[model samples]
Every structure is written in C-alpha cells, then in structure tokens.
Target: MNVMVAEHIGFCFGVMRALNIAKKTKERTDKPVFTLGPLIHNPQAVHELEELGIHPINSLDEAPGGILIIRSHGVPPDVIEKAKEKGFEIVDATCPFVKRVQEYARKLCEEGYRVIVVGEENHPEVIGIIGHTGGKAEAMNKRRIPVIEDRDRIGMVAQTTQSIENLKLAISYVVERVKELKVYNTICNATYMRQQSTKLLAKEVDLMLVVGGKMSANTSRLVEIARNEGCETYHIETKEDIDPAWFSGKITVGVASGTSTPDWVIKDVVEYIKNL
Candidate 1:
C-alpha cells in the first residue's frame, strides 16, 4: 500500500509560540509554572511540558504564585485580571487569530450591535470571546440561533478552529433574522489550509487517518470533514491506536493531523503505516 501525508501535518504557528513560551519559562525559573489549561489539546505535548516542570491547572485558585501561561485557546480579560490580582506573572500565549475574534466581538458590542459568536458554545475559545463582549453575546454551534430581541444590527465572529461550512451556515441563519449584519471570518489561515488539504487527500486515498487528541476540537473537525467526504476515516491519537486490519484491501492511505499535534507523533504514525 502507498501512504501520503498532508503537507501541513503538525503544530501551527500559535501552538508553536505557546510551547516556546512555556519551554523558555521552564529554562529560566525554578518557580512553579502553571498553565491555565492544557497548553495545547495534545496530551503528549502537555505531558512533555509536565516533565519539564510546567503544570496544567484548571483554576486560578489552585495556582498560588509564579508564572501562569495562558493556553493557546486564550482566556477572558477578567481571567488575566484575576491572575494579576493574585500576584502571578502572566504569559499571554493566546493565538493572535483568536485575539482578533475577541477584539471584533468587543468592537461589535460597543457599536450597539448584538454580537453572535459562531462556534461550539462550550469551547474555551468561544467562551473567551463572549467574555470580551461582557458576557452579553450569544454563541451558536449551527443553525440554532436564539430568537433575537428587537435589535436590527448583528455582528458575527467564529471560533478560530471552526470550519468554513459551519461558519457559513450559522451566518445564513442569522442573516435572515437580523436587518444589519456584520460578519468577520476569524478562522485562522492555517486551519483553512489544513481543512482544504485534508478534504483533497480524502478524495485521492482509500482510507484516511487523522491524528490528534480527542479533546481537540479542530482534530475532531478534521475527522468529521473526512467522513463527510464519504471516505473511511479514523481519528487516532497515536500509532498504537492504529488497526492493521483497517489497511486490508486498501491500496492507498492518507494521514492528516490537527494543529496541536506534534511532529514526532505524525512521523511515528507514518513510519508505522510504511512498515505495515
């Protein structure tokens, strides 16, 4: 069997930046360094950071002092404020694209337009964006936009990882409901390229393997996109999750990974496929 891998198969710019910041902090200080959440969605990456003395804690209350690295997903302004109040040194590692969305949401709210964030309601990125809007914005995953008040103006921004298809559908639903609508395409360039590459690969290969953490929203979306293209796709975090039997009768296969995925994980999975 022949195997192909997506051209963009590992950590994107934002994830790389966040990891570098964490690693640099570890190099300089003996103090406890805690991340607001998993530095990135990949478990292996987070585990690697832990080995270097960087820890992931869910709440600010749990971190007593030292440096706090905000995850790539970014946190609300208030989260940073609270951390500062507690005397923790802050490393803002929020993806620049996500920060753009938050700023757009805040601008829309200030301009008197009802803001709508187009993405998973429970996603940290979406929640962070909403916090920028002072917790008054609405978050909708698909077409389930809430009944709007008598507001005529509406502004929409998407979670940085959302697929264009999902963003467009959400916008279509809101377009009919509001009179004056503003839409900002906040999906990062890296994400858009990865989605396109994954879709293209799926059509050319007999089977597809998407590698990344299950908790990664973007990784799950890649699997969904491959399946939606009618290709047999499996989402796996590591080479151990691969089933040799799945490769039976397949002449060609393709591998793609989420932005948070590390280069070593992809190389291992690809090597395993070649050895099979």
Candidate 2:
C-alpha cells in the first residue's frame, strides 16, 4: 500500500506560538506553571508540557498562586482579571485569530447589534467570545440558528476553527430573518488550507486517517469532510488506535492531522502505515 499525506497537516502558527510560550514560561518560572486549560487540544502535547513542569488546571482555585498561561482557545477578559486578583502571573497564549473573533464580538455588542457567534455553544473559544460580548451574545451551530426577529440587527463572528460551509449556512439563515446583518469571517486561514487539502487528498485515497486529539474541533472537522467525500476515514490520536483490519485491501492511505497536532505524531503515524 502507498501512503499519501495532506499538504497542510500538523501544527499551525498559532499552536506553535502557544507551545513556545508555555515552554519558555516553564523555563523562566520556578513558581508552579499552570495553563488555564490544556495549552492546546492535543493530550499528548499537554502531557509533554506536564513533564516539563507546566500543568493544566481547569480553574483558578486549583492553584494558590502560580503563572497562568491562557490556552490557544483564548479565555474571557474577566478570567485574566480574576487570575490577577488571585495574584497569579499571566502569560497570554491565546491564538491571534481567536483574539480577533473575541474583539469583533465585543465591538458588535458595544454597537448594539444582537451578536450571534457562529460556532459550538459549549466550546471554550465560543464561551470566551461570548464573554467578550459581556454575555450578550449567543452561540449557534448550523443545526441551531438562533431566532432573530425581523426588527433585530445581527452581528456575527465564527469560531476560528469553524467550517466555511457552516458559517455560510448560518449567515444565510440569519440574513433573511433580520433587519440587517454584519459578519466577520474569523475562520483561520490555516483551517481553510487544512480542510481543503484534506478534501483533495481524500478524493484520491482508498483510506483516510485523521490524527489529532479526540476533543480537537479542527481534527473532527477534517474527519467529517473526508467522510462526506465518501472515503473510509478513521480519526486517531496515536498509532495505537490504528487497526490493521481497516487497511485490508486498501491501496492508498491518506494522512491528515489537526493544527494542534505535532509533527512527531504525524511522523509516527506515517511510519506505522509504511511498516504496515
């Protein structure tokens, strides 16, 4: 069997910047270093940071006083203020793309538009973006377009990892129902590249393998895209998740990974496939 890898796979600029900030913070601080959340979506990467003395904490109460690194997903401005009030040093590692979305949401809210965040409601990034709107904004997916009255003016911003198709669909749903609509295309360029590359590769391969953390939204999006292309696709975090049975009678295997995925993880998956 032959192996084909997507042109755009593995860590993007934002994830790399966050990882570097975490590592440097660890090197500089003796006070326990803790990320407000997993520094990135990848468990393996977070585990590696723990080994280097950087830990992930879900809440500020978990640490009495320590350096708090904001994950790439970005947190609410209030979160940073609270961490400061608790005497924790702050290292903001939020992705620039996500930061832009939050800013746009805040601006939209300040301008009196009914803010609609186009993304998963429960996602940390979406939560942070809503917070920027001072809790006035609502998050919605393609399946759940929020109710907008004909008199309501709507302002929209999407999760950086959101698919373009879903964003477009949500916009279409809102435009006809509202008095006016303003949208900021906040999806990351890297996300578009990765999704497009995965789609192209999936069309030419017999089997498609997506590697990244299970909780990674971008990774899951790739799996959805590949499956929609009618290719047999499996999402895995590591080589251990690979099943030889899936490769039976397969000629060409395509490999794609989320932006949070490290190069080493992708290399390991590719090596395992070559051996198989």
Candidate 3:
C-alpha cells in the first residue's frame, strides 16, 4: 500500500505562534502559567505544554494570581479586563485571523448592524468572537440560521475555521431576510487549502486518514469532507487509533490533518502506514 499525504498538513501559522508563545512564557516565568482553556485543540500538544509547566485552567477563580496566556482563539475584551482585575498578568496569544473576525464583529455592532457569526455557537472561538460585540452578536451554523427582520441591517463574519460552503449558505440565508447585508470572509486561507487538498486527494485514494484532536473543528471538517467525497475515511489522533482491518484490500491511502495537528503526529501516522 502507498501513502499519499496532503500538500497542506499539520500546524498552521496561528497554532505554531500560540505554541511558541506558551513555550517562551514558560521559559521566562517563575509564576505558574495558565491558559483559561486548552491552548490549542490538540490534546497531545496541550499535554506536552503541561510537562513544561504551562497548564490549562477552566476559570480565573481557579488561579489566585499568575501569568495568563490567551489561547489562539481570542477572548472578549471584558474577559481581559476581568483577568486584570484578578491580578493575572495577561499574555495574549490570539491568532491574528481570529482577532480580525472579532474586530469586524465589534465594528459592525458599533455601526448599527446586527452581527451574526457563522460557526458553532458553543465553540470557544465563536463564543470569544461574540464577546467582542459586547454579547450583541449571535452565532449561527448553516443548520440554524438566525431570524432577521426585513428592516434589520445584517453584518456577518465567520469563525476563522468555518468552511466556505457554510459561510456562503449563511450569507444567502441572511441576505434575503435583511434590508442591508455586509459579509466578511473570515475563513483562514490555510483551512481552505487543507480542505481543498484533502478533497482532491480523497478522489484518488482507496482509503483516507485524518489525524488531529477529536475536539478540533477543522479536523472534524476534514473528516467530513473526505467522507463526503465517497472515500472511506477515519479520524484519528494518534497511531494507536489505527485499525489494520480498515486497510484491508486498500492500495492507496491519503493522509490529511487539522491545522492544530503537529508534524510529529503526522510523521508517525505516515510511518505507520508505510510499515503496514
């Protein structure tokens, strides 16, 4: 069997930047370093950081005082202010792309347009973006389009990891429902490239493997994309999740991973396939 890897695989610029900032903060700080949430979506990567003395805390109350490194998913402005009030030193590691989405959302809200974020409502990134609008923005997925009045001015920005197709659907739904519509394509360029590469590779391969954290939205989307292309696809976080039975009679395997996935994890998956 041959293994074909996607052209765009593993960590994107944002994830790498967040990880770098976390590592540097650990190296320089004597105080306990904490992230309000998992620094990134990858559990393995988060575990590695814990080994280096950077830990994830669920809430500010959990930490008495220390350096708080914001995850790649930007948080609301109020959260930063509250963290300051709690005496925690803030080290923002928000991805520039995500920050842009938040800025657009805030701008739209200030300009008298109803802000709608195109992504899962419960997602940390989406939640953070909504907070930027002072809790005025509502998050909507393709399946759950927000109701808009005919007289309403609608302004839309998508979660950075959102698929283009979903964004388009949301835009189409809102445009007809509102009098004036403004939309920003906030999907990350790297995500689009990865999805496109995975779709193209799935067509030629007998089996497709997506590697990344199960909690990663981008990774889940890759799995969905490959499966939608009619290829047999399995999402795995590590080599241990691989089932040899799935490879039976398969001649070519295509491998793709989420932006949060690390190179070492992808390398391990590729090596395992080569050995098989």
Candidate 4:
C-alpha cells in the first residue's frame, strides 16, 4: 500500500505553544500545575501531560493552590478573575487567533452591533468568546444561524477552527437582512491550509485516514471535507482504531491529522498502515 500524508498534518503552532508552556512550567516549578481544562482536544496529549505532572481540572474549585494554565481554547475573562480570586497563578495559553476573535466580538458588542459568532454553540472556544461579550452573543453552526431579532447592524466572528467556507456562508445569511454587516475572518491560516491540503490529498487516495481525537472539532471537519470530496474517510485517535479490513483493495491511502494531534500519534498511524 502507498501511504500519502497531507502536506500539513499534526500539531499546529497554537497547540505546540500550549504544550510548551505546560511542559516548561512543569519542569521549572515545584508548584502543582493544573490546566483549566484539557490543554488540547487530543486525549493522548492530555494523558502525556498528566504523566509529566501537569493535571487538568475542570473547574477552579477543583484546583489546589498552584499555577493554572488556560487551555488553547481559551476561557471567559470571568474564569481568569475567579481563578485569581482563588489565588492561583495564571498562565494563559489561549491561541492568538482565538484571542483575536474574542476581542473583536467584545468590541462589536460594546459598539452596539448584535454579535453573531459563527461556530458550534457548545464548543469551548465559542463559549469562551461568548463570555467575552458578557453572554450576549449567539453561537450558531453551519446549518442555521438563528434569527433572534431583526437589527440594522450585526458583527460576525468565527471560532478559530471553523472552516472558512462556513464563515462565508454564515456571513451571507446575515448580509442581506442587516443594513450594516461587519465581519472578521478570524479563522487561523493554518486551519485553512490544512483543510485545503486535506481536500487535495483526499482526491488522490483511495482511503483517507484522519488521525486525531474523536472530540477534536478540526479533526471532524477534516473527515467531513474528505467525505465531501467523494472519498471514504475514517477519523481515528490512534493506530489501534485502524481497521485492517478497511484497507482492502485500497492502493493509496491519505493520512491527515488535526492541529491538536501529536506527531507521535500520526507516525504510529502511518507506520500501522505501512505494515498493513
């Protein structure tokens, strides 16, 4: 079997920065370090961090006195304030792109534009961004953008991991109805590159393997993109999830992983396919 890897795969800059901050803090401090949430979407990466003495605590109350590193997904400002009130030293590892979206959304809200965040409603990133707006923003998925009120001005921002196509479509939904539509294309460049690369690679391979956490939004998006290109795609977290039967009659396989996926996991998936 010929195994082809996407031009862009594995950890992106944002995930790498978060991991570095967590690992370095673990190495330098005697204080127990806790992440406000899973540092990234990849479970294997979080487990590895745990092995290195960096723990993930879901809530501020769960953390003992120590440094609290905010995950790359970012959190609402109130979360930082509450953690500070609890006396935990904070290290914010929010992706710069995500922070930009939050800032724009907040500014839009303050300027009196109805804020519309284009992303999954329940996604941590979207929730965090909405918090910046004092919980006054609306998060919607690609299928529908809810019409809460007819307004003259509306501002739109996207979750950093959202597809550019989705952002554009969501903007189109509001463009005509609203007298003035403001939008910030806050989708990370790396995300666009990866999605495009995945689409291009998917067309050349018989079977497409998307290796990342099942909960990873970007990884799921990659699977959707591959399938949209008329290719059979599987989203797997590890080599163990690879089904040998799926490789039957497949001459060429394409491998693509999400931004949060570690290089080691990608290598294992690739090597497993080679052996098959």
Model 3, 48-160: lDDT tens digits are 99999999998999999899999999888888999999999999999999999999999999999999999999899999999999899999996676778999999999998
Each prediction's RMSD to truth: 1.2, 0.9, 1.0, 1.2
Residue 195's lDDT within candidate 2 is 95
Each candidate's number of clashing pairs is 0, 0, 0, 0
Better of 1 and 2 by lDDT: 2
- Write model 1 residue lDDT over 210-258, tens digit each, in one string: 9999999999999999999999999999999999999999999999999
lDDT of 4 by residue, 1-276 (tens): 899999999899999999999999889999999998799999999999999999999888896779999988999999999999999999999989889999999999999988999999888999999999999999978565687445568888988888887887888778868678889888888888999999999999999999999999999999999999999999999999988999999999999999999999999999989988
Which segments of model 1 are wrong by more than 4 Å?
149-151
Per-model TM-score on C-alpha atoms: 0.97, 0.98, 0.98, 0.97
Poorest lDDT segment (10 consecutive residues) of candidate 4:
142-151
Where model 3 places Cα greater than 4 Å from the true spot, the runs are none
Q: After superposing candidate 4, which stretches have Cα over 4 Å from the reference?
A: 148-150
